[model samples]
Target: MRQKTQRRWRILRRIDAESRALAETLGIHPVSACVLLNRNLTEPAALQHFLNPSLESLHDPYLMKDMDKAVARLRQAIDGQERVMIHGDYDVDGVAATAMMVRMLSALGVDVTHHIPHRVDEGYGVSAEGIRQAAANGVKLVVTVDCGISAYEEALLARELGLDLIITDHHQPPPAFESQIAYFGAAVAVLNPNRPDCGYPFKGLCGCGVAYKLATALVENLGHPGNALQRAYLDLTALATIADIVPLRDENRAIAQFGLERLSDTKKPGLKALMGVCGIAGKRLSSYHVGFVLGPRLNAAGRLDTAETALNLLLTRDDSEAGRLADALNQLNRERQEEESSTLQDAELMIESGADALGGDILLDSDKALVLASEDWHMGVVGIVASRLAERYVRPTILITMGEDEGKGSGRSIRAFDLKKGLDGCADYLVGYGGHAQAAGLTVTRGQLSQFRARFLQVADEQLGADDLIPVVDIDCELGPRDLTFELVNELRRFEPYGHENPGPVFAIRGAKLLDQCTVGANGKHLKLRVGFWEASYDALWWRKGDNFGRFSRHQLLDLCFSLDINEYQGIPSMQFVVKDVQPS
Candidate 1:
């Protein structure tokens, strides 16, 4: 774990006293006032927009680069009654996007088929074999969501085979690839927010979010703004946006907020049943629900078997089958969790024994470029395990699982390093590699392991600094006992659906007296404490903080940073602080 530091508090300066006056004048809570102050939501209009998140504020879908061409091509295909296939990645984001496209096109009476590439065999995006398969099935046009940005060779092959492709992806492009080669060997409308040529603002949309935009453009162009089928696909957009862990701000924030509303009455049987099984039914499902509950279940099918299971689950309208599939996915999730834990434990053990000896940015090599392989390691769970290892070790962690005659590697990197770029720098040793800066995958020959390790570490040593290896906590503002209130908590809702870049605000409170304390939850994993000044008691719960019991006590003065949350039990609403940290004074 990165060591914690106690520093002098710096209040966010952007918030003037007017926000506080607004809170006081409007009978809003001070906590909400602080939240507003922290996010620099000082302007009345901005505050109003944050408070009233509506679809009207959303940017035009056509603002996306190539959105016009993509919609035009799709309309042409629909008008021509041409066979079109929705090519999607195997992950949750890709699958959800695929489902969204399929639903919309089918509603429009377009002949549409959806195809998800197998993670193990086809890897990601548009594969050569997948294109051939689509052609064999009479698919003349293909729209790829969440992938195909890096499939230059596959796109070339598809063009030769007489297929038309539209690429919609959000991953950063390789320096060498300026534009995505569409299926017809020519660069068609490649809609990627990360492309330098694209001028549309808000570059952090998830693949499914991009797909939803495309669908919206298509529907709007078709002059059907009130199309029920068009709006129904927002739930998929919400699922993918949250699942992909993109920054939930601006357009993404609106999509997630709107999507959650629709998800409450979602038409997808598999999703409804999955939520039921996970016990999130009738509760306010946040981005956390998508990440922890829904995403993993959908991902399990792709990881353990094929993504088709998840795609079918989303597309299937049958209730009984949805129940059965939900059960199967739940079981798969449990099995996956077990595999992840065991693999993580084994990796930890390996590090404990020799990690220190071979330190300087970890390079755990065996016969493969990375030796995450164990008899117990499930291939589907390795990427997550690798990410976890990277988070803990502060290194570019590569988890390799032994495959027949070759080894597959999944890597996760820190902010200072780019995994894909680094892998691209050492492309001679790798057979194939593709991913974003923070996460990537590659295949390496056993003979190239040593050379790859040396090259990777050299790149890290040259680029990274000591501070880059350590995690930094950036607090939004400072607060006192009198500052936290129910009204304040309500105001904080302006920052709802927080993820990635626009994280929920973390506020620091110094010299707070701990009035009461206890451990609760299953396995006593959570810590609860009443903190306050005289006559003011604010309840706080630290999920997964029992491990830090040694540092906390009742009646002790402490400094803490936390975000306010509301807990509704039996229809009674109560406020709670989701504690981020607590340091004894």
Candidate 2:
């Protein structure tokens, strides 16, 4: 056993008094109050905002940059009875957005057909062939959701074909079109918060969030709040908001909190069946449910076969058919998980062989601009893997699945790096690229892969630093052993639905004793232990921490960082620490 070091408690100098005051005012423990203050919820208004997330508090949908123009164009199409095409990306955000728009238009009695581009054939966004197909099918107006903000070439083609395009996307803009592409207003109206001059109050919206705004603006303008379709689509917006992993803050929090409520009693046959199969029917759902269980199944369709399966499942109205589709999606999710593990192993090996030794600023490349091939690398899971790789490496990472002549790659980045801006720096080597600061996608020619790789590395070298690459854990307060109490734990519940931006609070606990410890789980992969603090002993489990058990010893005093969680096991509810890290005393 390793010896533990004595620990000292610390507090932020500026907020010490304020934290104490907040605890008194809110009737919560001092440590819980400190956690709230640490999250910048110091002001009364901030506390109110966090505690009461209501729809009336939501930001105006029209506050978005392209709202007026996008709404105007959609209204015109509806008024004229023009044939409209809802062209969407294949992921959950895209599918939900497409389904929302389609249902709304169908209710408006407009001729609308939804089209989700196949992952294998069409890749992402509006392709030339996709645009041509829409035109040939008499799609007079094309509204793109969750994608196409960066489709300069494709938008130009739509203009030439006399098709009106309204792009409601959340991806970052390409360099050439970074400054208001105007494909929408000039000929179409493009709605995206990330536009350099968009002037939208919040720029953190996901693609589906933007689509929801578009739908909201359209429905409101048409004076149809009571419309069945308008009401039904809110659940889609909720699913997308949760699936896209956007911060549950500001308007997004309002949407998701209420949206989950809508999902619990959803009237849509497809959603009802999907929820039933996932064993969440009639239960209050949270973002955790969407991210872990539902999102993967919806995404599995695109990863293993065609995203059309997901789109169909979302759009269908038959219980039996929805059940069949849901089962298939569940199976596909299992297949995706298996393939993801295999690819991740190879990626882990490649990174371990010194590629990621820098501990930051990772650059992954091969004969292709990004090597996406692993015999069974399901396309859907690659994005998730790429995101994981980026987070692990603490740098922008591009994971590619090789194509015949070129390759398709997805890029995820850390806060210090703006992935889209970096990709723009290497535009000469890219066939096409676009996405937000943290995540993006691109196509690169085989011949230019070397140049792209070099440029990417150079950009990182110029832009990043040693400190910028390391992970940061921001603590709200330091609590002594005596501070562990059930009341304190229950008081923290005021801040429910914690997620990105408004993360669950982390607290420091000092002078704790490890009463018992053991490596548990299948193959002894996890750490399980009993920790004694205050006058009580509590059970604690740390997933994937078996390898790190060297940091603690039996009956050793130590400092621990963790979040409090209420775990209900076998009808017993108890407070447990979701252990983050441990240090010697």
Candidate 3:
């Protein structure tokens, strides 16, 4: 029987000989060495650093471009006792950055107020209204985190209002078509690795990571102990680093590595309460917990309510207050999930009813992309829905909420397509747009939506090839049931803090006999399988693959691609196979 969805398996070329040599020298398993080699960590020093990251491995904070200027301005503000305002975005990175800045400044005995813009009302970045409010409050200096590089008008507005502006962001600078040097407009200092003039060695720091660097520099210049601050705040940096979806390599890997260790003992009342609410308290934290468990709860306030709720939670000192705020965020996350599910259903319906519909299978359509809009959809969750649609249909997707005169929306794209460039090509139909290559947001007048949709689809069709539509699973190596041992799985744990550019290694297994299969989970949304190879049997869990349970029978031979992990139950730990894909042998 054929599977409902098609997947492409691209097995990585094995470096078995190199792995054996490296393993002997490094005192590790060949499989672990192979995974490291696959990630291009061939050098001994790089491998050792990756295996055991340390705080000393972090780069100097002053190495970034504009560091001196930003530090000087902040020092002046602190020395003069000027009222400073930290303007932040509404996402997790923004929330974490805002919290870090507020705490860092407060520790220096400087008066700092923060403003997190409402997602619906203020959109993103530094807004003129936010600046005007800061001015009205007699703010002398304004610092932005996670946003502001593209705030050309807002930066000018700060100048007009006689307020100094410092932008600490990780987003790419505004595109410069004609000039060789990137223009950051009129900010006092722009601290961003993506800036053309920036000499930061690692360009993948998240917004909070940049904020952490700024805070570190400020603390050192103030004659305060810097190590204590870094240790105290790395949990926030790690949370933002994972949540921002930035590549986890170089400095980012070190931050995440140290941050995960710090998270289990985080002193923040808010983080403790959040972990408790998420049922992750007292456990060894990882990037997975930050990205999937904690990140969404922090993001819920920004998505469903005002971001200030989340920012306040992080800034609060009272334990009871933290508990209350955590509860509120938990409830909001539930609401967000419901809204996302509903919106996704509506999007699927639209695809099925549209001209490009194909036999009830969204992925079997001729359309290069899916652009959907609904006045009834919630604006906050459209981005997540767009991502879900893009993954399911294997095409770039945009979901919009139509307003009276304008349509606001977000988009998600596959690897072969660059959404930012696609939007650039259709700039005429858009009122405004901003974001990265894989995701973006746009606004257009209702009258221009049809044209924007058509233009976007045209761009995707021109750029995407047939192979681009098929999802590719890159297998690190082929393995057998006999190799699935607790020791090997434990060694794989060195690749902790996996995300973005560094994912958990996937392995392929050939000709395994299906010993047993059954549906599990609350709604039978998952599958539990027993497979045997040679004389060894293993337990496998297939998430969201329960619909295919009937396709396999006892003694059926199958090929599988999976990742290895340790699953614990009733005080017992054992190796578990997480199935990625399966096919008949």
Candidate 4:
């Protein structure tokens, strides 16, 4: 189902002579310059870098707080021929990070094994049981990827078990201590850019990026000094970076651009097999391919079961094993989709059904944030459902699967609200919680469900105002029939592989007369309309908006916000407006 929430259009462009001057100086379209200015890239050098972020310009790995310590510890482990375990979470980011570490460490002659904690049994982060088991297995060094920032107790457990730990994580660290030490000084080193004391210039790195940084530093510390080795793993870094939904700014842009290039011709059988299964085998990859097409499949293993399948797909050299793992991940993703759809339906019914499903006589609209739960809901699918509800309702939403004594839930919040901070405010009611500002996972005892709900709503109320609850569709600029051209669309295409922090440009046009309209696609699931401003009539495709066919009529003046695209048919290419939002003018 699609979200029904109407969005407020926020036009970001204004008359700016600087953008015009920049366009003239840079020999590019003024619209592109305006978009770059919107991202605060004014200087020519900065604009150039933004347009083409290169791997050669990556920040020094040693700039991170404990990169040296982490590298030195890993070097010691290698010298001693000690067994090292790469601890990872079950998600794509963690699995990618783990895969990179295993490859890098194995190449350096280290006896490397990896552990991906079971979602149900071990939950998340550096597991205490995992640490003890690693010790029992004669693993002398434990290195965590994509997790362990919040593993204070687990860090202590590793220390008690006489194991040296090097933590590489990207999650927001807890409130600072006096020393600014990483992970409560339980391990040898923690390499996280988010550590308050870490002076790493780019803090937008996802967990896999951090792991790549550590790998770079470690390899540079040893005989290999250049980035040839680092470039080899860009495929994994890019995959995890896009999958993790981190900002695509600074080095991340370079990592993604270069990594996507490498992924197109990846040497790894596992990635190739995964891509083949995703039906993107020979295509030049982009963030969309990774984020939407491949990411969910890789994430499915972690969500439905363990991340072993996904991790194996990244690590396996055998084409047969890679194909098997890819197929397994694809099957798991289908199951995950079914679970997510069912849970979303259940939650939507609960929201619309009113007082009986939701709490009290108050309707859902009365609360600033939703906290919906069901015993029948699968824990793995709640996060996906929460994201859907948050998008649909235009507010923060938490979906919990009730257990006998406790409930495990996930919360996805609007950009205006910080979910992690809100969970911090309700820490007293939660057993544990950790994640970024927009998404978080939590465990709450069954007894405190109502209290937690009330507290979370209070937090949302305190942070979000009436305006914040309404979603905003940012319009890069306005365009008329004359302004929409093949040239403009071609220039906008420069910002390919757009994602977080760097979204594709959305343009709006006002008072376009709807000449004709019809439904398209299976079950009439899409809208195909012809709208004109003056002498120019353009076709518009509103994906999944066929249900809105009744909203407007022929000859009606309508306002449309859309992104430009060139639709190619056979041997010819024609301009197509991919509509995002539409309303009667």
Candidate 5:
């Protein structure tokens, strides 16, 4: 069966005068300038910076709130030769962040160790048991990377155990009380951009980005070559930044831009081995490689096994050990994929069943939200399943793994809905919850699952409008077939390292005729087409869209939304179009 397209297409409107002015001043095509303008790069300096992000454009690390304090404490620990513990989360961001901090400290001649919480056992953040263990191990200082922003109780516990705590995280802090002066109660320093009081210019850094800032400041304060050390750790920072799905703008853009360059020739044996195993070594890397290939491999260790496996891979200097760990992680990733596919299938089957089977939950009635639960679902893969479900259904989706008494839930939301806020509205049913606007995690008691599901659905229904349900195809600008030149495509390369806020441009072509088309790929799941207007024609690849092959005939007029790409075959690079959506004219 063919799936129908349910997206609303809107071409971005641009002021002709502004486009003309920008094009003339920047000495570029009007369409390119219009795309920049659409991204809010209007000011001359801003446009220049956006096009050519420089390493110097990165803000000073000291500007972050508590930077000086965190640095001073860390320097003292280093000077005193005290034992320090790096506490990190279990995901890719946390693993990279932990590795970055550990390496920086080790280079500074400090006695440092690291701890990554077990995904199913310890849960997220700095756990009380972990801090107690650190204290038992004679650790005088504990710096948490990628987590601990919401560890109010754990912070207090650290204080009680006489362990100094420094929290470096990017996740939203727990709500502060009106009378409370700071969010992380007993921690010596908390470095997070999301804190309301912090005045750091850019607030979009991921957890690893925050950890990198701390590392940068610590390296510089100790009279070391800060930039040199920063360069060494850029691969790790970039890996986490991309994997964590942070916005690639401002300092982040510079970090990813330079990091990708550095990652191409990474000297770290673990990363080199990982790249080799993933079959991306020696290739020019991009956010795509980090986000898809390497990130998942690193994350798989934490998901199915211990995060320490990934951390050890990052810290190991032995080539043989690195290869073994890389092989193990690759195996774990394969296992993770299998679990994800099985869980996704089970979730879809549950959805296909009727509401009566789900105890008449409101989620079944409104279809505005989905709250799927199963005792058999693996917790690590539920988030991926939730993301897929949200994208497919065009609504917020929560997948929960039911335990004996409580259930752990992960949620993904459509653009119009704020998942964190939705969870907040249903807080009465949740034991605890946290996350950002688009994604979140929660814990709900098995007894209250029905109530939470109904309440979450109500929140989605009340908040989401009918228009918000339809997916949107936001065209950057309209381009004629004549504009599909190699020069213009090369100029577009200036907008590199696209992610989150800074997206690759999408252009629409009107009244194009399909010259030839065919179903391709395994299972004929891709549509390969030659489309053109007048005398100009280009090859187009529509992925997973072969079901629509029957809708088109040769010489049929169609409107196309697509992104320009460069496809290389036998060392010859040629222009190709990635078809996003096609409709009859």
Candidate 6:
């Protein structure tokens, strides 16, 4: 289906003869081989690991920087019976990481508790208040999960309070601190693969992935089996790994694959209850289920209320408590949906009424980035709005909720722009900021709102070009209607748990006849069509495109790009197309 805004479709080059041979050698389809080759997985070992992920695929946890030190400190805490508090962020990644650390440490008989900060109150990263509370509770050690990379002050505070601090995070660190472990935020150990000096082979671990590493190291250090403990933590690692939107390759992919398998029959009462509430219990789960279905519900706790609720859900062993917590999360998710839609509508209205737009009111015209702020905006939901705006407008988008004297904003960016690095360029305007390249959070004084917007847009203009602004739909391969078969679909299933860099393969078919069309679903918001290639006909669904129902006619010849899918109804399975884009021939 065509829209006013045309997305750039880039088809990857077809695989060569050698790749076809590799496919034969691997006993897989050429399409699967092409997808693997597109990701530059030409080596035999990498291909085998990807095809059949196993415990051997995971790297040694000791490879991460400061892992040994972190493990030793944890041993001391265990042997001496020292009190420990785990400091974690409020998002899905943070909560999962926290839950994993707390559970694993408790299993090892360490005196451990966790603190998940309130989003609106404590904001992101390690908070000084949390450290103070831990000290007040006589906690002698503080371990952070999914946060503390930029907590120089908080780390120092922990030290002054006579508490040993260990920082476990995966966010990009300050450039100057890459080689200088001595300045690792005054913490005894900082375990982040992104650290330049760290020799970890894979650098795309999420917060929970790093925390899992520490857990495994501790298990092996304490003279227990590593793989068994690793398996024990995969469910949480998988949840955070997918939720955090890290690259799904290397060890991250293995964790996701194995984790989804474990999540299917999770023994955790909280996870089981959550899956029941989400209506996904006893079903084969995928990355889609984790990232879209479960992640948001877990995230809703933090976005609308306290993330402690979600953390509590994960930690709870009692079935009744899990049921109550899951129900609470479900309700919070509904509220979150309403708030997100309301905030998104407000941002859209602001853009539509250009007068309300900051930075000289050039939002829809010359501006390369979107910087929107409003006192009426909810601080917790602005990040979701920023994500929608960034994806819809194909620009780096920042949505801020203005406070009395300052504003807290979340920014999401496209491939062309590195959001954290861009924020680094605007450091003069920001009060503080920390996050990944694609997503980040920041603080700015109300006075500097306009200046920060202008500078941010300027940086974007310098970095992005006209082509970079266009969203690219990367087509992995082009195939005929006859190529769509159960075998091919099964092969595609092998690439499950896809996210970020390893998205589901997109396929393109040229000159398919549009046989019939109609709007389906509630409010007639979805487009359903009968698409055919010669005598081969298949049902296709174009979600959220009912507005274009009358745009095409019967027997129309069109080029369609879609992902192949299977629809099962009444114990019958058939091939179908999940349409992406359509163009007239």
- Tens-digit lDDT string for candidate 4 (1-585): 435667899999863798788889888888888788888888768877888778899999999998888888888999999999999989889999999999988988999998989988778788878998999999999999999887887888898889998888999987643354434578898888988878999999999999999888888888796577756799999999999989988899999888999889999999999899889999878788998899999999989888898999999999999999999999999999989888888788778876324262325667888888778887888998899888878889888887889988899999899999999999999998988889999999989988988888888888888888788999988876777888988887677668999998888889999999999998999999999877888899999789888679889999999998887889698888899999888
- lDDT per residue (tens digit) for residues 1-585 in model 1: 334334334455333576568678656755556666666667777767777777777777778888888988988998999989998988899999998899889888989997887877877667888889999999989889998777788778777888888989998876667543343245467888887888878898999888888888888889887345436887888889888888776778788898987887787898899899999988787877888888999999999888888888898899999999899989988888888888888777766555421232333332112334433456688899888877666677787665556667788887778787778778887777888788888877656765776777667777777666665456776766666677666666656787776678787878888888878887789888888777777788988777666566667898887877888889898877888767677
Each model's lDDT comes to 0.77, 0.76, 0.86, 0.87, 0.87, 0.87
Off by over 4 Å in 4: 1-5, 176-183, 355-362, 533-536
User: What TM-score fits each model?
Assistant: 0.88, 0.88, 0.96, 0.95, 0.96, 0.96
Model 1, C-alpha of 59: deviation from truth (Å): 3.0
- What is candidate 6's local distance difference test score? 0.87
lDDT of 6 at 333: 89
Q: Which regions in candidate 5 have their CA more than 4 angstroms from the true location?
A: 1-5, 177-185, 355-365
Kindly state the number of residue pairs that clash in model 2. 13
State residue 167's C-alpha deviation in candidate 2, in Å.
1.1
| lDDT, residue 486, model 4 | 89
Q: What's model 2's overall lDDT?
A: 0.76
- After superposition, the stretches of candidate 1 with alpha carbons farther than 4 Å from their true spots are 1-49, 179-184, 226-230, 355-376, 418-424, 514-522, 530-532, 536-539, 550-554
Which candidate do you rate higher for lDDT, 4 or 6? 6
Q: Per-residue alpha-carbon lDDT of model 3 for 1-585, expressed as tens digits?
A: 122357888878565787899989988888888788888998868877888887888889889988999999999998899999999999999999999999989888889998988888888788788999999999999999999877777887898889999999988775751152223446778899888877888899999999999999988898878788878798889989989999888889988888888888999999999999999999999888988899998998999889988898888999999999999999999999999988888777777666321122223367788888888888999999999888887889888888889978899999989899889999989998988999998998988877887788788889998888888889998876667888988888878889988899999989989999999997899999999877778889999888888888889999999999888899898777899999898
Looking at model 3, residue 205 earns an lDDT score of 94
lDDT digits (tens) for residues 1-585 of candidate 5: 124347789889553888888889889988898889888988778877888899888999988999999999998897899999999999999999999999988887899998999988888778878999999999999999999887878888888889899999998876652234443457889899888889999999999999999988887887788679767999899888889999998999999989889888888999999999999999988788988899999998887889998999999999999999999999999999999999988887777674422354434445688888888888998899999988877889899888899988899999999999888899999999999999999999989999898888889889998778778989988987778888888888888887888888899888988899999997898999998777777899999889878789899998889999898899998888899999888
Model 3 deviation from the true structure expressed as Cα RMSD, one decimal place: 2.6
State the lDDT at 322 in candidate 2.
Answer: 90
**Cα deviation of 77, candidate 1, in Å:** 2.5
* Residue 195 accuracy (lDDT) in model 2: 77
